[model samples]
Target: MTGKVLPLGLPLAIGFVAQLAISFTDAALVTRLGARELAGVTLALSVFSMTMLFGLGIVTAATPKLAAAHRSRDTGAVRTWYVQGAWLAVLVGLLGTAVLWQTRDILTLLGQSPSSARIAQRYNTGAAVGLPFFLLYVNARGLLTGVGRPKPVTWVMLAAVPVNLGLGCLLTFGAGPVPGLGVFGAGLASTLVRALVVVAVTAVLLGGGFRELALRGARLVPRPAMLLDLARVGVWIGARILLGEGFLPVLAFFVARFGADATTAHAIGLRLESLVVVFALGFSGAATTVAAWARADGDWRALRDLRSSLLLIGLVYSLGLSAVILASSGFTGRVVFGLHEPKAEGMLHKLVFLVVAYFVVDTLITMSMGYLVGLSDTRLPTLVVAAGYWVVGLGTGVLLSELTPLDFYGLWLGVITGGCVIAVFVFARTGQHIASLANSTTEEAPE
Candidate 1:
C-alpha cells in the first residue's frame, strides 16, 4: 500500500505544499495590512473555496468514469468521457464564477461589517475572473489523472508556486515599476497565476499529450447521457461540499459575532491547520486513484486491502502531523505568524488544539470519501458527510457555543465529538459494504 500510494500521493502532496505556501504567504502578507484586512481575505477565500466545489465535483465524477473506460480499453468511451467532461467543466466553471461574484452580498447577509464586506468583495471580484480558467485546468488535469498520469499535474502545480508567490508579493508589496495593490492585488496575482496554469494545461492537452490519449477522435460537444452520468455522481459530491465546506461561512459568522480579532485569529488558525489537512487530502486522492484502478481491473481484494491500508496510513500520518502541531503551534503563532496581540496567539493556540481532532477524523473521512468514490458509491457517503459536517459537527458546535459555558471551546469540543461519530459510522458503512461484496462472491462461487 505504501509503495503504491506514496508515489502517487507524494507528488500531489508536494503540489499541496506549494498550494498551502501560497495561502500561508497570502495570509502573512495580508496580516501586515490589518486584522480586518486579514479577516476580509479569509472571507473572500472561503467564498472562492465554496464556489469551486462544483468544478471540483465535475472532476470527481469524471475521474472514476474515465478511469473505468480507460481500464476496459474502451477507446470510444474514453473519448466520450474526455470530450463531454471538457464541455461540462466549462459550464461548471462559468457557473462557479457567477456564484463567486455574489460573495459580497452573501458576506453582508452573513453579518460581516460594511468595511470588511467591501474588502472581501474587491478580492472576490478578481478571484472570480480566474474561476472559469481554473475549472478548465481541472478538466485538463482530470484527463491525465483518470489515466493515472498525475505526476505531470504535480509538476505543473509546483512550477506555478513561484509564479503565484512572486507575482503575489510583487503586486501586494510593490517592487520596482509596480504599485502595491494590497489585498486586491494578492487576489489579482492569484488570478493571473491561475491563468498561466490554465494555458500550460491546455498546451499539454493539445500538444503531444493529446495524441498520447488519442483525444484527436473525441468530439467537443456535450453528450447528454455522459453529462447525466457525470452529474448523477457530481450532484451528490457537490452537495457534500456545499454542506461540508459551506459550514465555513457559518463558522465564520459565529467568529464575526465574537469580533474582528476573533475572526482574524480564526482565519490564521484555519490556514495554519489546513497545512496538515492538505496532506490527508493528498492521500485521499491517492486512495481514490488506487481504488478507481482496482475497481476497473475487477480487483475486489485490492480494494479490501486498500481500505485497511488507507486507514492505517491515514491514522499514522494524522498522528504525526497532529503531534507536530501540538508541539509547535504556540511558537508558530507568536513568532512565525507574529500574532502576538491580545488573545490573538491564544486563540490560534486553541484552534490548533481543536484541529488536532479535526485532522484525526479528517484522515479517515478523506480516505472514506476516496474509497467510496472509487466504488461509484458517493450517495451514501454524501449522507454520511452531511450528517457529520452539518448536522452532528456544526449543529453540536452551535448548540454548545450558544447554550453552554464552553463558549468557543464548546464549539470545538462538539466538532471533535461529531468527527468521532463520522469516523465510526463511515467505517461501519464501509464494513457492511465490503461484507456484502464478499458474501455475493462467496454465493456465486462454483459448487
Candidate 2:
C-alpha cells in the first residue's frame, strides 16, 4: 500500500505544495509591505481560493471517471472525459474570474473596510486573469493522474516556484527601472506563472504518449450529454468542496470584523496549516485513483487493504505534522513572518494549537472524502460536509465570537467542533459502504 501510494502521493504532494508555494510566497513577501497589505491580499486570496477550489472540485470529477476508463483500457471513454473536463474547466474558469473581478463590491457589501476592499480589488484584478489557465492546468492534471503519469505535472509545478518568486519580487519591490506595483505586482506574477505552468504541463501531456488520445478524432466542441454527465458528478463534488473548504473564506469575512490584526493573524495561521492540508490532499488524490482502479477490477481485498493503510498512515502523518507545527510556532510567528506587534503576534500564538487540531481532524475528513469520491459516492458526503461546516461549524463560531469574550479563539473553536462532526460522519459512511461492497462481493462469488 505504501509503495503504491507513495510514488503517486509523494509527487502529488510535492505538486500541491509547489502550487500553493505561489500564494505562500506571495504572503511571505507581502508581509514586508505591512499588515494592511497582508490583510488586504489575504482577504482577496481567500475569495480567489474559494472560487478556484470550487472550480477545481468540479474539474476533479474527471479523475475517478478517467481512472476507471483507463483501467479498462477504454481509449474512447478516456478521450471523451478529458475533452469534456477541459471544456468545463474553461467555462468554470471564466465564471470564477468574473466573480473575482467583483471583489471590491462583494467585500464592501460584506462590510469590510473600504481601504482593505480597494487593496483587495487591485490584487483580484491581476489574480483573476490567471483563472482560466489555472483551471486548465487542473483539468490536465486530472487526466495525467488518471493515466498514472502525475510526475510530469509535479515537475512543471516544481519548476514554476522560482519563476513566481523572481517575478513576484521584481514586480513587487521594483529595482532600478521598474516601478513597484506592490500587491498588484504580486498578483500579476501569480497570473504569469499560472499561464506558464499551463503551457508547460500541456506540452508535457501532448509530447508524452497522450497526443493520440487527446487529439485523435476528438470533438473540440462541447456536447450537452457529455457536459451533463460530467456535471452530474461535478456539481455534487463542487458543492462538497465549496462547503467543505469554502467555509474559510466566509469565516474570513467574519474575522475581518474583529480588525486587521485579527485578520492578519487568521491569514497567517491558515497559510501555515495549509502545508499539512496539502499532504492530506496528496494522499486523497492517491486514494481516489487507487480506489477507482480497485473498484473497476472488483478487488475487495485491495479495498480492505487501502482502508487499513490510509487509517494508519493518516493518523501517524497528521500527528507528526501537528507536532512540527507546534514546535515551530515561535520561530514561524516571530522571526520568519516578523509579526512584531504584540496583539497580532499573541493572537497568532493562541491559534497554533487550534490550527493543529483542526488540520488533524480535517485530514481524516479529506482522506475519507477522497476514498468516497473514487467510489462515486459523492451526494451524501456533500450533504454531510454542508451540515458540518455551514450548519454546525459556522453557526457555533459566530455565536461564540459575538456573545463571548473568547473573540478570535471562539471562532476557531467552532471550526474544530465542526471538523470533528465531519470526521465522525464521513468515516462511518466509508466503513458502512465498504462493508456493503464486501458483503455483496462475497454473496455473488460462490453461488
Candidate 3:
C-alpha cells in the first residue's frame, strides 16, 4: 500500500522541482537585464499565469474520471474523456487568447508601468498562441497521472525547463548573430518551447506511450456535458485561484504605501515563496493521483494510507524548508534576488523571515486542500480557501494598513494567519471524514 502511493507521488515531487528550476533559471537570467526588465518579466509571467492556471485546473479535474475509467478497464471511456479534455483545453485556450487580445488595455489598467505593460502584452499574446498546445500537453499529463504514469510527465517537465531556459537565454541575451530582445524575446522563446513540449508529449502518447494499457485513439469532438462537468469543478477551483489572486492587489496596495523599495521587496519575496509552494503542490499533485486511484479501485484503506503518508511527509518537508531559509537567509537572498544589485535596499534579513514564515503555513494548507480534493471532497475546502483568503487575509491586510504601523508585515501576517486557519480547519475536517469512514467500515463488518 505504501509503495503504491509513493510510486505515484514521487513523480509529482520531481515535476515540481522541474518548475522551480525554470523559475530559478529565469530569475538568474533576468537579473542581468536590470530591475525594470526583471519587473517586466514578472508582470508578464503573472498575467500569463492567471490566464493559464484557470484552464489547467479545469483540465486537471478530468483526472479522477479518467482514473475511474482505467480502473474499470474501460479503454473507450478513457479515450473519450482524454479527447474531450484535450478539445476543451483547445477551445478554452482559443477563447482566452481572443479575450486577452481584446483586453491588453484592461491589463495595463491593472497598474503595470507603460514599459512593463508592453512587455506583458507581448508575453500574453505569445502565451495565448501557445495555450491550446500547452493545455493539450497538460491534458495528456492528466491522462498519464490518472493511470499512474506520472513519471513520463515528470521527465518531460524536467527536460522542458532546461530547454525553455536555454532557448530563452539564447534569444533574450543574444548568442551568435541573434540580437538580444530582452524580456519580450524571453517570452517568445518560452512560448515556443512550451508549444513544442505539447506536440512532443502528444506524439509520444499517441504512439503507444502506454501500450500495456491499450489506450485507443478516438475521434475528437466537443462533449458539452463533459465540458460542463469539467467547468463545474473548474469554477470552484478557479474561484479558489481568484481568491488567492485577490490578495495580490491588497498586497500591492500595501506595498505602494512603502514606495518602490518595499514594492520590489514584496515582489521578490513572493517569487521566493513560489519556490516553497511548488513542493507542497508536488505533494498535492500526488494526492490527486492517489485519490483518483483510490476512488477508481474503491480502496478506502489505500486512500487513508496515502493521505496520512502525505501529511506526515509534507509536515517534515515544510519545516525543513523553513529551517533552511532561516539558516541561509543571506546566501539565499543574494542568490535569488541579486543582493549585490544596487537599489534593493534592506532586502536581506528584513523580508526573509516574513516570507519563509508565510510559506511554511501556506504550503501546509495547500497540501491539505489538495488531499481533500483527491478525496472528492472539494466544496468545503474551496469555500475555506475563498473565505480565508478574501475575508481573513485581504480584509485584515487592508484594514490594518489603514489603522496600524505594521506596514507590509501586517499584509503578510494576514496571509499567514488566513492560511494557518484554513489548514487547521481542513486538517480537522479530513480527520473527521477518515474517522467516520473507519467507523462505518467497522460497523458494516460481522461482529
Candidate 4:
C-alpha cells in the first residue's frame, strides 16, 4: 500500500511545489514591477482563472469515468471518453473565451484604477487567448490519469515549470533581444509555455503513449450519452468553481475600497495562502483519481476505504498547515508579500488566519465532493455552494462590511463562512447518500 501510494503522491507533491514556484515567480516579478502592477495583474489573473475553470471542470469529469473504465480493461470506452472529453474541452474553451472577450471592458466598471484596468486588459487579453491550449492540456491529463498514465503528466509538468518560470521572467524583465513588457509580457510568456505543455502532452497521448488505451477511430467520435452524463457533473462543478474563484475578485473589489496598496496586499495574501491550500489540493487530486477507479470497478468497499483515507489525509495536512500559517504570519508577510506598511502589518496575521480557516473547510469539501463526484452525485453539492456562497456568504459579507470594522477582512470572513457552510452541507448530504447506497447494496447482496 505504501509503495503504491508513494508513486502517486510523490508526483502530485512535486507538481504542487512546481505550481507554487510558478505563482511565487509571478508575485516576485510583479511586486518588483510595483504595487499598481501587482494589483493590475491580480485582477487579470483572477478573471483569467475564472474563465479557465469552466473548461477545467468539464475535463475533470472524465477522470473517474476513465479510471473506472481502465480498471475494467474497457479500451474502447477509455478511448471514447478521451475523444469526447477533448472535443468538449475545445467547445467550452471557445465559448468561455467569447464570453470573457465580451466582458473585457467591465473591469473598469468594476472599480479598478484606470491604469490598473488598462494593464489588466492587456494581461487578461494575453492570458485568455490561450484558453484552447490550456483546456486541451487539462482534458488530456484527465484522460491520461484515468488510464493510469500519470507518470507522463508528471514528466511533462516538471519540464514545463522551469521553462514557464524562465520565459515568464525573461519576457517580463527583458532578457537579451526580448523587450521588457512588464507584467503583461509575463502573462504572454506564461500562456505560451502552457501552450507548449499542451502540445507536448497531446503528442504523447496520440502516439500510443503510456500503456495505450488502444482507442478505436470509430469509438473516438463524440459520445453524446457519455458527454451528457459528464456534462451534468461538469456544469455543477463549474458553478462551484465559478462561485469559489469568482469570489476572489469580488473580494479584491472590496479590498480596492481600501486603496491600491491594500488591494495589492490582499492579492499577495491570497496567492501566498494558495501555497498551503495547494498541499491539500494535492491530496484531493489523488483522492479524486483513486475514487474514480474504485467506482468503475464496483468496489464499493474500496471506494469507502479511499474516501476514509483521503479524509484522514486532509485532516493531518490541514492541521499542520494551519499551525504554520498562524505561527509564521509575520514572516510570511515579509517574505511572500514584502509588506512594509504599518497598517498592513496588524492585518497580516488576521489575513493568514482567515485564509487558513478557508482552506481547512476547502480541503474537506474537496475530499467529499471528489468522492461523490466519482459516484456521479452532483446536484446536491452544486446547490450547497450556490446557497452557501451567494446567499449566506456574499450576503453576509456585503451587509457586515457596512455594520462592522471588517473591510477587506470582511471578504476573507465571507469566504470562510461560505466554505464552512458548503463543507457541512456537502458532508451531510454525501453521508446520507452513501449510507442509503450501502443499505441498498446490502439489501441486494446475498438475496
Candidate 5:
C-alpha cells in the first residue's frame, strides 16, 4: 500500500505546496503595506480561489475517469477525455475570469469597505487575466495524477517556485527598472507564474508520450456526451468545493465586523493553516487514485487495505502536525507574522489552535471525500458539504460571533463542528458503499 500510494502522494503534496507558496509570498509582501492592504489582498485571494475552484472541480472529474481508462488500456478514450476536459477548462476559466474581474461591485454589495474593495478589484484584474492558464494547468495536472505519472508535476513546480518567488519579489518590491505595484503586483507575479507553469507542463506533455495521442486526431474533435458527463460530475463537485472554500470568505466577511485588523488576522491564520491543507490534499489525491484502481479492478481486498492504510497514516500525521502547530505558536508570531503587541500575539495563538482542530477533522473529511469521489459518488457528498460548511460551520460561527463569549474564536469552532459532521457522514457512506461492493462480489462468486 505504501509503495502504491507514496509515489503518487508525495509529489502531489509537494506540487500543491509549491502552488500555494505564491499565496504565502503575497501575504508576507502585502503585510508591509499595512493591515488594510493585507485585508484587501486576502479578500482578493479568497475570491480568486473560489473562482478557480469552479474550474478545478469541473476539470477534476476527468481524473478518476482517466484513471479507469488507463487501467483498462483504453488509450483512445484517455486522449478523448483529455481533449474534451481541455475545452471545458477553457470555457470555465474564461467565464470565471470575467466574474472575478467584476468583483468590485460584488464586494461592495457584500458590505466590504470601499477602500478594500477597490484594492481587491485592482489585484483581481491581474489574477483574472491568468485564470484560463491556471485552468489549463489544472487539467494537465489531473491527467498526470490520473495516469499515475505525477512526478513531472513535482518537477515542474520545483522549477517554478524560485521563478515565482523571484518574480514576486521583483515585481512586488520593485527593482532597478520596475516600480513597486503592491497588491496588484503580487497578483501579476502570481499570474505570470501560473502562465509559465502551464506552458512548461504542456511542452512536457506534447514532447512526451502524450504527443502520440495529440497527433492521433483525438485533440481535434469534441465528444458531447462525455463532456456533459464531466460537467454533471463537476457541478456537484464544484458546489462542494464552493461551500467548503467559501467558508473562509464568509468568515472573512463576518470578521470584518470586528475590524480591519481582525480581518487581516483571519486571512493570515488561513494562509498559515494552508500548510496543513496541502498535505491533507496530497493524501486525498492518493486515496482517489488508489480507489480508482480498486474500483476498476473490482478488488474489495485492495479497497479495504487502502482504507486501513489511509486511517493509520492520517492519524499519525495529523497528530504530529497538531503538536507542531501548537508548539510553534510563538514561532509563528515571532517569525511568520511578526506580531508585536500582546493582544495580537494572543489572538494569533488562539486562532492557530482553532485551525489545528479544524485540520484534524478536515483531514478525515478530505480523505473520505477523495475515496468517494474516486467511485464517482459526488452528489450526496455535495449535500453533506453544504450542510457541514454552511449549515454547521457558518451557523455555529454566527451564533458564537454574535451571542456568545467565543467571539470570532467561535467561527473556527464552527469550522471544527462542521468538519466533524462531514467526516462522520462521509466515512459512513464509504463504509456502506464498500460493504455493498463486497456483498455483490460474494454473490457473483462461483458456486
Candidate 6:
C-alpha cells in the first residue's frame, strides 16, 4: 500500500508544494510593500481563491472517472471524460474571471474600506486574466493524474516556481524601464506563469506523454449528455469544496471587521496553514486514484487496506508538520513575513498553534473526501460539509469572535470545532460504505 500510494503521492505532494510556493512567493514579496498593501492583496486573493478552488473542484471530478475508465481500458470513455472536463474548466474559468474582475465592487459591498477595495480591484484584474489558463492547467493535470501520468505535470509545476518568483519580483518592484505596479504586478506575474505552465502541460499531453491513452483523435465537441454527467458529479464536488475550503475566505471577511492588523495576521496564519493542507491534498489525490481503481476492480479488501494506511500516514505527517510550525513560528513572523509590529507578531504566534490543531482535524476530512470521491459518493458529504462549516463552524466562530473576549482565538477555536465535527461525519460515512462493500463481497464468495 505504501509503495503504491507513496510513488504517486510523493510527486503530487511535491507538485502541490511547488504550486503553493508561487503564492508564498507572492505573499513574501507583497509584505515588503507594507500592511495596507498586504491587506489589499489578501482581500483580492481571498475572492480569487474561493472562485478558483470551486472551479478546481468542478474540474477535479474528472480524476476518479478517468481512473476508472483507464483501469477498464475504455479509451472512448477516457476521451469523453477528458474532453468534457476541459470544456467545463473553460466555462467555469470564465465565470470565475468575471467575478474576480468585479473585486472592488464586491469588497465594497462586503464592507471593506474604499482604499482597500481599490487596491483589491487592481490586483484582481490581473489575476482574473489568468483564470481560464489556470483552470485549463488544473483540468490537464487531473487528466494526467487519473491516467497515472502525474510525473510530467509535477515537473511542469516544479519548473514554474522560480519563473513566478523572478517575474513577481520584477513586476512588483519594477526595474529601470518598468515602474513598480505593486500588488497589480504580483497578480500579472501569477497570470503569466499560469499561462506558461498550462501551455507546457498541454504540449506534453499532445506530444505523446499519455503513452497508450492518446487524446489526438478525441472529439472536442460539447456533448450535452457527457457534460451533464460530469456536472452531476462535479457540481456536488464544487459545492463540497465551496462549503468546506471556501469557509476560510468567508472567515477572512469576518476577520477583516476587526481591523487590518487582525486581518493580516489571520491571512498570514492561513497561508502557512495551507502549506500543510496541500500536503494532505496530495495524499487525497493519490487515495482517489487508488480507491477508484479498487472500486473498478470490485476489490473491497484493497479499499479497507487503503483506509488503514491513510489514517496512519495522515497522523504521522500532521504531527511532523505541527512540530515544524511550532518551532519556526517566531522566525516566520520576524523574518519570513517581516511583521515588525509587536502586536501583529504576537497575534501570529498565538494563531500558529491553532493553525496546527485545525490542520490535524482537517487532514481527516480531506483524506475522507478523497476516498469518497473514488467511490463516487459526493452529495451527502456535500450537505454534511455545508452544515458543519456554515451552521456549526461559522456560526460558532462569529458568536465567539464578536461576543466573547477570546476574540481572534475564539474564531480559530470555532474553526477547529467545526473541523472535528466534519471529520467525524465523513469518517462514519466512509466506514459505512466500506462495510457495505465488504458485506457484498462476502455474499458473492463461494460457500
Flag regions of model 4 displaced more than 4 Å.
1-10, 20-38, 100-103, 169-184, 206-209, 215-220, 252-269, 395-415
Clash count list over all predictions: 0, 0, 0, 0, 0, 0
Model 1: lDDT to the true structure: 0.76
lDDT of 3 by residue, 49-132 (tens): 677777777776777778778878888888888888888788888876776563357557875668777766665665567667
| lDDT for predicted candidate 2 compared with the true structure | 0.86
Candidate 3, 108: how far from true, in Å? 2.2
Select the stronger candidate by lDDT from 4 and 5: 5
* TM-score per model over all chains: 0.87, 0.88, 0.87, 0.86, 0.89, 0.89
TM-score of predicted structure 5: 0.89
Alpha-carbon lDDT of model 4: 0.72
Q: In model 5, where do residues sit more than 4 Å from their true spots?
A: 27-39, 169-185, 209-217, 252-269, 347-352, 396-411
RMSD per model, one decimal? 3.2, 3.2, 3.2, 3.4, 2.9, 3.0
**Per-residue lDDT over 280-335 for candidate 4, one digit per residue giving the tens place of the 0 to 100 score:** 54555566677677655555666656656766777787878789878988887787
lDDT of each: 0.76, 0.86, 0.72, 0.72, 0.81, 0.86
Give candidate 3's error at residue 386 in angstroms: 1.6
Q: Please list the residue runs of candidate 3 whose C-alpha ends up more than 4 Å from where it truly belongs after superposition.
A: 20-37, 169-184, 245-249, 259-261, 340-351, 398-405, 435-447
In candidate 2, where is summed lDDT lowest over 10 consecutive residues?
208-217
User: Candidate 5, after superposition: displacement of residue 147 in Å?
Assistant: 1.3
Candidate 1 residue spans exceeding 4 A from truth = 23-39, 169-185, 206-210, 252-269, 341-352, 398-407, 439-447
Give the CA lDDT, 0 to 100, for residue 137 in model 4.
77
Collision count of model 3? 0
Cα misplacement distance, residue 260 of candidate 5 (Å): 8.3
